[model samples]
Target: MDQRPAISASQAGDGVTLAASGNWTVTEAERLNGEIRQAARLPSGTRRVTIDLSGIDRFDTAGAWLIHRTARNMVNDGLEVVYTGIGPSREILIGEVEKSDRPPAEPRREAPFVTALVNDTGEAVIQSGRDLVQLSSLLGSTVLIMAGFLFRPWRMRLTSITYHLEYMGLRAVPIIALISFLIGGIVEQQGAYQLRYFGAEILSIDLAGILVLRELGVLLTSIMIAGRSGSAITAELGSMKMREEIDALRTLALDPVEVLIVPRLIALVIALPLLTFVANMSALAGAGLTAWIYIDVTPQTFLPYLQNAVALNTFLVGLIKAPFMALVIGMIACLEGMQVKGSAESLGRQTTAAVVKAIFMVIVLDGLFAMFFAAIDY
Candidate 1:
């Protein structure tokens, strides 16, 4: 009895018969594969094909699969295929292979451009609504926690708040001042260039003073904080979430929000107004220096014009917007951080989202404040 796998094909009355012999296990897989392929190539005009399996002394899944595949190929080529001498055991093995060899379903067609656009827009709107709800919930929770702390001042985390203030405020001042100064100088230069054409270059001081105090100072500071402090906050929170530290706090009966977020929020609210004040003064200094350099307008002449152009209300307006902008940045950063999943990629993505959302909300908030001030003639 040869143990090597073999197959032979013969013709009988307009049909073909395939006889398989020897071992059909994996040891003979290479020979069995060739034999199976040869057996599947039936003679032309053969209307029926039969695979005889009784001669096989040993069989396995590999052998069953080869037999099933040959039979399936013949059937696909429009021949009636039958199996002979396949005992109950081998029959079950072949049947399992057949069951697993189903054709793949057709692919779905892509939607039209307009339909895809509408679907995408709808999804974005839905996601935005969900974000709004989540943010509102967090805001409410934070407010309640703060309210409780008001009555129980001893419960407040002053050290944490002070630590955050040192980082988000005191450390942030130099960069904020540098950027504000450059922006102010640019504004003054451009204003003087335009006003010189109207023989009013001296008025550039007035323009810079009003713009810096009323708008540019707080807006630039907020944008910087959104990119710097807000991203840092998101990354910190996201890392904590990934490490399961947040969950650990929960298990210990501590509110993660009260313990982690309130201190940061309080620090932001306290620090932003001070930063805005620094930004305003820096910008004014830059503007005055640029005015003297570019337009030959000395501080002696620039001061009276600036004083006449911008009142106390102008300075107060930028300060008034700072705390609100700080709250928006802190809330967005914390929310994105809390939403982080358990991965480094999630932390990176959430940090980026926090910065973008905070900047967008800050600008929108500034516009709203502007409109409100105008309506109230403030």
Candidate 2:
């Protein structure tokens, strides 16, 4: 029996006729959900939707969610969404999620361009001041956590941290390396194309070298971590918060900040820089390959050029930025996770906010570094 969900679109009375029939699992439900969306958006006089799930023998949360997202998207476009003939099992799941006590989020406020600018500038200054003030607190907290871990290594979730690193650090390297390598390759290739005409192909080495060190290496590494580790950190703390583990730690007279936050934050602060250093290496290696392929610069000649173009200070300045970036990612994630209220929804929101804030901080720090290095002629 062909059990895939049905997707048929046609013109019905006043709106549209979008119908689907299937049990949606996490894997296949999304595909059917997409079908529903396409049918609902059909250019017809149909003023409403009639989703049929009668063919669906059994369904779960995934099915309910598929209906909700599709329905919500339709509602946002001033249309309605409903099931024409929901089966008994599917109806129960949808009823629970749809009728659940979910309060609407607070309405957002908009500001004019000038007001937004002024507000942002003020907020930036205030946040910068707050960051400076909090740095000392972070240092003290980190030291205390390290002391506790050193004294009671068993108390430190060593396996948990290792498992996390295996996923976030080791598993992520290939993707980062691929992207960094391609970025380096593309930059050199483009420069070679342009410079070949001007007889400046050699300059491409210095250009890619400095740019990779100063910008792409740190920025891409941080961004990757924000997506990978930052999200994981937020999710970890968020799950703990959701399950009342954070509160339980309080009940046990343990400071969640020192016990939970510090270890993860410190680990990130250490790991990110090392990961970025590897990213820089891969980027330059790829650049060397591109130089060879595009401009006939062999590895032997290119290695010396890269060496000459890069100095200890050049690498050191970028390394100096990593701890700060890692701190931003870790702190923002932990802080946001800690602030999540009593709900799974709030945890997801804070997790997303953590990633976004970390990425933003990474970029801002990059700009600051550029100015600082340029001013100092480093």
Candidate 3:
């Protein structure tokens, strides 16, 4: 009784028999693997195969699985396979392996292009509606909280509001002024170049004045805030959410929105209008200087043309849009932050989404305001 693994094949009139003997266990896996491979190569005229396991000295799952795999491969190659003399224990082990050895899965088919497009469009529409509902709910809750503050003014977070104002507004002035100044100078140069053909280069001052006051001042400022302050708000709140500080606030019987969101929103509302005013003046100053250098239109001449070109309503229109844009940016930032999951990747994703959505909404809102003003001939 040799205890080493061995396999031998015999052929007789289109039939083959494979006899497996000795220790068919993990200890003999290396030899058993070679023997199993050798057993698979049968005589050319053989049409049927039988695996005789009666001589096996010991058995285990590793050997059973190898034997089952060889048989499976032979069956797949169109040979009839049979097993004989396998005792109850070995048979059970082989049966388990057979059950676990599943065939390869088929590839998936793709949907038609038109069907996929329709499904994507429908999902976007549904998501937009859901976003609208959630934003409205948040607005309502914020309004309620503010209304409560009317009865208890001391509950308002004035210190937080002041801090955010300085952070979002005061610290932002230098970059905003630089950007606005460059834009105004470019606008003036382009206007002067075009108007010079008609010998009306001085009118570039009028163009810069009216455009900045009526549109560019507030629009550019809002976009800047959306990219800068809005993203910061989302990141801050998202970090709090990831650390479970927001949950801790809840446990302390405090409203996270009231403590965290209201102050930021109030600060934005106050800061944006002031920033818009700064942007308008900076743009006007840049335009005037460019006009003087490019067209020799002195400030003395530029001032009168600017006065005649834009009215009080023109300035008020741009200022009026600021607080609304601020509100939109704040709400979108807070909503995206609150949706952050407990992961750094989620925080970064939500922060990017906040800036994108806020800028888009700000532009859309500006368009609506423009349409309203045109309709009323304001």
Per-candidate count of clashing residue pairs (backbone under 3 Å): 0, 7, 0
- Per-prediction CA RMSD (Å): 5.0, 15.6, 5.9
TM-score, every prediction: 0.78, 0.62, 0.76
lDDT of each residue in 1-378, candidate 1, tens digit only: 687789999899888889999999887888778867866777778999888998999999889888888887778888999989999999899989889999888899999999999999999999889989999999999999999987999999999999999999999999999999999999999999999889988888888998899899999999999999999999999999999999999999999999999999999999999999999999998999999999887889878878899999999999999999999999999999999999999999999999999999999999999999999998
Q: Residue-wise lDDT of candidate 2 within 240-353, one digit each (tens)? A: 988899999999999888678776775777688888888898899899999999899999999998899888888887788998998888888877777778898898898998
Candidate whose TM-score is highest: 1
Candidate order (lDDT): 3, 1, 2
The regions of model 1 sitting more than 4 angstroms off are: 1-107
Error of 1 at 256 (Å): 1.4
Q: Which ten residues in a row have the lowest lDDT in candidate 3?
A: 38-47
Candidate 3 ranges with C-alpha deviation above 4 Å: 1-107
